[model samples]
Structures are given as C-alpha cells and as structure tokens.
Target: MTTPVLNTVLVRCSHTYQDELTVGDTKLLLDTTFRPEWHRKISAEVVAVPRKLNTRHTAYRGLKLGEIKAGDTIYFHYFGLTKENRLDTEDQDLYAIPYHEIFCKVREGVISALNGWALVEPVEVKSGSAWIGTDSEKISTQEGILRFIGHPKTDQPALNVQAGDRVVFSKNADFINTIEDKDYFIMQQEDLLATQPQKANEIESDYAGPRHYYETSPFYLSPDHD
Candidate 1:
C-alpha cells in the first residue's frame, strides 16, 4: 500500500491574559495571537514571509479579519488601525504617538520617524544678537529653527522662552547651539536659562499656549489682534 504525503504548515499567533507584557515575552507570544482575521483581507499564503522589527506595518481601525493580509505582522503596543489616539499601552483609550509608524514592507503604508521631539531649525538673529532696543531694535524674520516647546493645546501651564534665551537642543546640541557661517539665533550665554528638570505631571504651558485634550476641546477664536 502507498502512503499519502502530509502537508505541515506552522501558523503564528499570540495574545495576553494580563494587562501588559515584558518586552522579552513578546516574540514567544506572537504565534498564539494569530487569528483568522490575519488572512481575511490578504491571501493566507503570504503569511510565510519573514518580517523585520522596528519597521512599519499596516494599521487598521478594528480587529476585522477581512482587512488584514497574510504577510502582515502585528507590533503590539504601537498605534491603532484607524483610531486617532489609541496605542499599545495599559490604557488603550489614552492618546500617545499621533503619527503611525507603518511597516515599510506593506503596500500603501507610510512610516514615521517615531521620535518624541521635533526639530527647531536655525533662525537669523540681528547682529548676531536677539536684543537691540526700541528705536534700534532688530527684528528677526523666519530664519532660524524654533525649538518645539510643546503643543499649544496640551501645554496649559505656560513655559516661556524669550528672544535672547539659549536652549540646548536634545538631538543636536553642537550644531544647534553654535553660530555658523549663516546668520542664526544663538542666544548669548548670559540670557539663557539653565536647564531644569520638568516634572512628568507638570504641563509646559508657557511657550506652547494651553493644555487641553485635543479630541474633547472646543474650537476658539484668536483673542489677540494681529
């Protein structure tokens, strides 16, 4: 008698019984969480492809199996499929990284830098200084990098930086703080404030305007005249 050939396929899946998972356990937990939804949208044959980490993936709004593809690998603790503020955290409802870091392998997918801080390019300071005087006061046009103090809506407490204050850019200190051949806004050392540790709970409102949950806040007209 002839024996029949058997086809063996290893399907990957994972999930959590608890609220959060240790980073070390994530890989082992993946295969168990794989669901029918994984191949509902895309052909099931594509799941065999190997995926790299720290890259982008297709982000869907819900857990609909019909929307996912075979090659797609889910990176838990990241952005939600379609929702604006939902992310992979203890509180799925709480807002985190607004920009989604999509997997580059997936078609029609875009990726984000996934950085917390924004870049403030160099600005031109008048006469290599920020201050002049009333009659002789020099004006600075849009020439230098403006440090991203904070979001106007989320920072309600008010943190202020004057024209002549120096700030150390977290990402690029030497390039940002020093003067180059081109005119830039390098505040004199005397005018700069020493860096102070900000409390996590404390919102930076001075530079940015006010702190309000973007989804819940109402629209308001500009109170100040131009």
Candidate 2:
C-alpha cells in the first residue's frame, strides 16, 4: 500500500518571550486589550481547510514531508528584545556545544555564522496550519502553504497588512511552557498585533504617519489618518 500523503505538516516555532513577562504583566495586558469578537471577524476571511486526521501514519517523518511549499508562511511568534534572567540548568546538555564555548567562538570570530544553533533564553515553540488553496484545491489532496498575513480591520490598520502581503507580527504572551521540546499552537490570522514587510521594501517612501508602527502608542491610534 502507498503511504498516504497527509494534507498538513507539523512545524516547530521558537518562543518569542520570557516566562516572567508572559505570565506576569504581559499576559494581563493582552487579556485586557484582546477582543475575541473582532479577531473572529478577521479570521473569517481566510478560508479554513479540513485537516487530516491525526494518526501514527501521519506523524512528521522527515524534510520531504516537512518542507514548506510555496504560498505557505510559517508565523513565528517569539519574544523579541527582552532579557532572560532564568538560569536553565536542566536543559544545558540539550545543547550540542556548550553555550559558553559558542559565545567564545563567536567573540573570537572563529564561527562566522550561527543559525538554529544559537539559543534564545526562555525559548517557547508553537506550530499552526493554514490552507492556501481554494475550494477545489482544498477538496483535492494538494500539498502547499500560502504566504500572506490577512488585512486587519479598519480600526487596526496599524497592522497595515494588505492581502497577499507577507508580515511579521509582534506581541507579548500569556503563559508559555519551558519543558516541551517543541511548543505547538494552531494560530489564526487574527492573532497578529502589528505587521511589516516580511522582506525589505523595494520602494522608498518618506511619508511616515503610521504605515507601520512598532510602538504600542501608535498601534492603539486610529489608522484612519494615514
């Protein structure tokens, strides 16, 4: 019998924030501002595809089955620009090379580049699925992912996302697990806070009322002006 090709693949995304912030003040802030009804409306625009049944046969085997195809964009939500004071002694051995040694090598200019090997303190991982195909393709057993963050509501235009445009989202977290090898969570487009061009802008523009605001102040402002 031929191996059944599953419609969805598992992905591992790094945790974006520290545990202290997520559980303490950060979570509180998100709980206060997040409006479920508004987010649901945003998610409705993106068509949901039927997910294949979770079975032993469908579990992630390797890269051929895991490679992200065109139209699919993995939304990585992790803590950015925060100090991690927690001492992670238990998972020290999980590193192939000691953290100190890697730091030394990098400082000495011995290692020029570090990709996934570089560790983020208090790292949390999550995964989700998005179907890029239309009704016909969804019905068929096609394999692919779409690369676009949905357009935000009129009030949230600071998200500044245009349809078919790739974006990076940033926001604080609630609670994140420190034990899971890979943290996985199914995410919808509505969960996004702010978005900017995934890649560098090809064209330059001087007008900057609020095309893409990174600060929380600008984020809360009305997008109607710009």
Model 1 segments more than 4 A misplaced:
1-113, 127-144, 147-167, 170-226
lDDT of 1 by residue, 1-226 (tens): 1111111111132322222223433422222234423212111112322221222323322111222234433222222222442234443432222122211112234211111222233422333334222111242222223333322112122336522233433222222211121212222222223443432332222222112232134642233414
Top candidate when judged by lDDT against the true structure: 1
Query: In model 1, what lDDT does residue 48 have?
Result: 29
lDDT of each: 0.25, 0.23
Q: For candidate 2, lDDT tens digit of each residue in 1-226?
A: 1112343322211332222213222342233124322111100000111133233332221112222222232222222111231124442211111111111012221211111111111111122343222122232321111122222222233333443343332222211211122211112334443433433322212212211122356445343444
| Clash count, one per candidate | 35, 13
lDDT of 2: 0.23
Error of 1 at 102 (Å): 13
Off by over 4 Å in 2: 1-5, 13-28, 36-66, 69-73, 76-226
**What's the distance in Å from true for residue 21, model 1?**
53
